[model samples]
Target: MKKILAALVVLVTIGTGSYSYAASAEKAFARVEKSGTIRCGYFTWQPAFMKDPNTGTLSGINYDFMDKVGHFLGLKIEWAEEVGIGSVTEALGAGRIDVMCASMWPDPAKMFHTEYTLPTYFSAVYAIVRGSDKRFDGNLNSINKPEVKVCGIEGDITANASRAAFPQANFVGLPPTADGSQLILSVVSNKCDVMLGDAPLLIDYSKTAPGKIRKVAGVDPVHVFGEHLLVNKGEHHLKMMLDTAITTLVNSGEMDKVLDGYEGVYGAPEKAFKPLR
Candidate 1:
């Protein structure tokens, strides 16, 4: 009888927890719909997404895509100023933003802190080096040697991934915000030997400068992952809405227009973000 009672208690406890989560999710769902504005936190990254530093402009596939989501939801996308990737979890928890539209990768460490929508995109990490510095080219083993000075921005996901993957090499960390400008500058100016970052951004950077920085060709990504929009934890309804909106865009072919130059992974479109036809 005691064992049966204990089992009943366990079931009841689990039921209560689930109910609490559902309640919180409903609050979040109603909150966004009531406010009529989804405040999206974002940072200025590169290639696929960024807030232009010079003009303070938010222009990228992320912005363009999320704008459509807001429209469909009968809400306006209120752009919230977010400076660094490291502080995104804090921003969402502190109620600074309703969602994170920055090209944020759902790192394992952060998974417990926030809810993530299905990935809107996928990108590969590459080694950024000077065009003339062909030392590591086609040689995966070369970058792991101690002589190679690989750098990543402090608190950035790449920092942890690169450090873990290349323990043999000297991995350095620049201050926050270096992921955009300073990381590349360090590689180009010889302040660092190499940078492990997104391949598309590095390729575009190399093109702009012609030879200042180039991707180490033929090196498969040390890390490849999907990017997702994030919201506060327990906001299950909010996440579902976001997931549906993303799939809707993909199914209707409007996502192709926004993701024109970016790479991503899309699931089968089930629910439409709007009318399919």
Candidate 2:
């Protein structure tokens, strides 16, 4: 008799919890529908969400995704350009933005009141070096050798990883907000030995100054990689909406279509570390 009573309690608890969750989700969805506009956060990261110089319009893989998502929900996209990747989290926390799709990594420390959507894209870290610098033997392991000078973005995971990966090498933290082109220029100009960063961005920069920059083979191991989008936490409806939209995009090959549109600018899209759904 007691066993049956306990089972009944468990079933009741589960049913109540599910119904409560559904109620909250419906409420959030109604709120968004009433608003009629979804404020999306944008950063200046090229080929991700950037302003086109020729047309003065915002267009990129991230922008394209948000546009489709907004359309699907019958909401207009309102752009709120942020200065740096860090600002994307800040804006989301302050309730200034409804969704964040700036290629921002979903760091735990920055996730206060923010939720990460499915990882819509991925890229690996590459060791970008000047063509004349042959110290790196095309192997990332060589970067940790003693006397090697390695530069990474300051206050980022790359900088933190540098100490573990290259305890013997001299690790220099470059300012995080510096443009990708400028970062590569610093290395190409001999201001730094090697620039460690996203492989696609480095590959894109190498095209401008041919013969000056070259990428070292082998990507950063899984432990050191990141992929994500940021949205308001507790917004279950919004989260599900995004998840469904991403899954549809991935399945219909629309994700590839959008990414391919910017392939010329950002290089080939890397495989997602996890399922888009």
Candidate 3:
């Protein structure tokens, strides 16, 4: 009887431990379902996700896309916090936000902490330089030298790609909170000789600072990456939920409508490529 009781106790303890593990694994999805809301952490990225400084109004492609997604899923989306590129995954890991509402480049380093949904669209990263600079006009290899200073937002895709491509070059990294203009400023002020950036972002920035920056002539795009929504790692249920919604929206042409509405408001649509089915 004593041995049997000890065995039963061990069984109960093992079962309890397994249940706890399962509960922890599904915590994010369970919380969202219970609340009927998906709290979002977003970063301001022009037409993708923007906040009007004066009015605090939010309007952008992802904003509309996610809104429609919530409607389809019958869940409310709360734009709970504005997160920086460096801290977005940290927020997810800490359960501070349910997901990142804005579309992001799936940087490999972030994969350990976060999971990405199916891509909604794609963009190209280009090497930007001062308009008058022609040192690397056709010779992309020249820019990889150690003397070249490359500027990029810290913890962003630009910085990651730049580091990978130009391993020998000097890197001038801005804080994750720095805006797009700061990247151009790094080049304008000679703080950096080159900066890698998204094509649309650079195009938009060029309008405000004409003749200040241009993509490297004769060199192809440095990299092209898909734009995807993000959730915490191990949250496969939530990721699949988003993936299905996005795929449905994209297939039904709803995603295109959102992109069409933003055309020329910023230098989008022209630079944004639709995702291939």
Candidate 4:
């Protein structure tokens, strides 16, 4: 009886140790600390986010925020693959990256797979059509037709919302290949009849490309949502670290300074971003 009891105790100890090892290994934040790198996943969008294709350099409100975050964690920010809206959930779920560098909005579908740090900003989502195309002039409902080819960034909140708004339209997604500024490119190039994206971004885009695309006057968002960065599921440690960094920036007014600069440069509306509560 003594020998049997001893063996059971040994088994229990081994099991407990194994669980501790597995849990530590599964933690994304611990891995980040060991590696000293945060693999950040991002996609191509411009005005005030991601990289500029012409210069092949990173800039924008998102970039500034990540820079501050990297400074706080003492981790080098390594740009990972440019992930699209369509596959961000899969990429994060597979542990392909440590963090999502670009901002994401809330969606029930996405919430099922991953988790978010606190929201960073609120951007107005809008509908854009080629300036010469009067087909959707001021009529949001008219856009929901089979002939209209609507394109949006795959995995984007706008993509999901656009589908809800224009269910009958032949909506297509810009694959990851078109990840950078391509959704807007599609509308301006006439590859699609409409592009649904951030209002300020599209407005800024219209200025650069001149008379190519224009927002439909008074087109309301399909719904309201806030932009946020993402962390792998149950990565509470990583989530807390990022949330702290962002909240620090907000409290210090540094984030607003960066946003103010971008808003001036990108023509973002005054009400587009508000300080976190």
What is the lDDT, from 0 to 100, of the residue 271 in candidate 2?
60
TM-score to native of every candidate shown: 0.81, 0.75, 0.86, 0.80
Best by TM-score: 3
Q: Candidate 4: what lDDT?
A: 0.72
Segments in model 2 whose C-alpha atoms lie over 4 Å from true places: 1-31, 53-55, 106-108, 111-113, 161-164, 218-226, 263-266, 272-277
> How do all the candidates rank in terms of TM-score, highest first?
3, 1, 4, 2
| Candidate 2 lDDT, 134-232, residue by residue in tens | 766546677776677776556445555556667778877677565566667778767667765665666566667567777764455424254566776
- State the RMSD for candidate 2: 7.5
Off by over 4 Å in 4: 1-25, 52-55, 269-277
Model 1 residue runs over 4 Å out of place are 1-22, 25-30, 261-277
Better of 1 and 2 by lDDT: 1
Best by lDDT: 3
Predicted candidate 3 versus true structure: per-residue lDDT over 1-277, tens digit per residue: 2343234334544866653424458567768767888999888777687788999999888899999998878788999898887778788988989989888887988888889999887777788999999999988889999899998888777688889989899998899887667788889899999987776677677778788899899988887778889999888667767887888998898888887886775656433454453
RMSD of 1: 8.7
lDDT digits (tens) for residues 77-144 of candidate 1:
88876757777778877787888887676576677788889867666667778888988889767888
lDDT of 2 at 98: 73
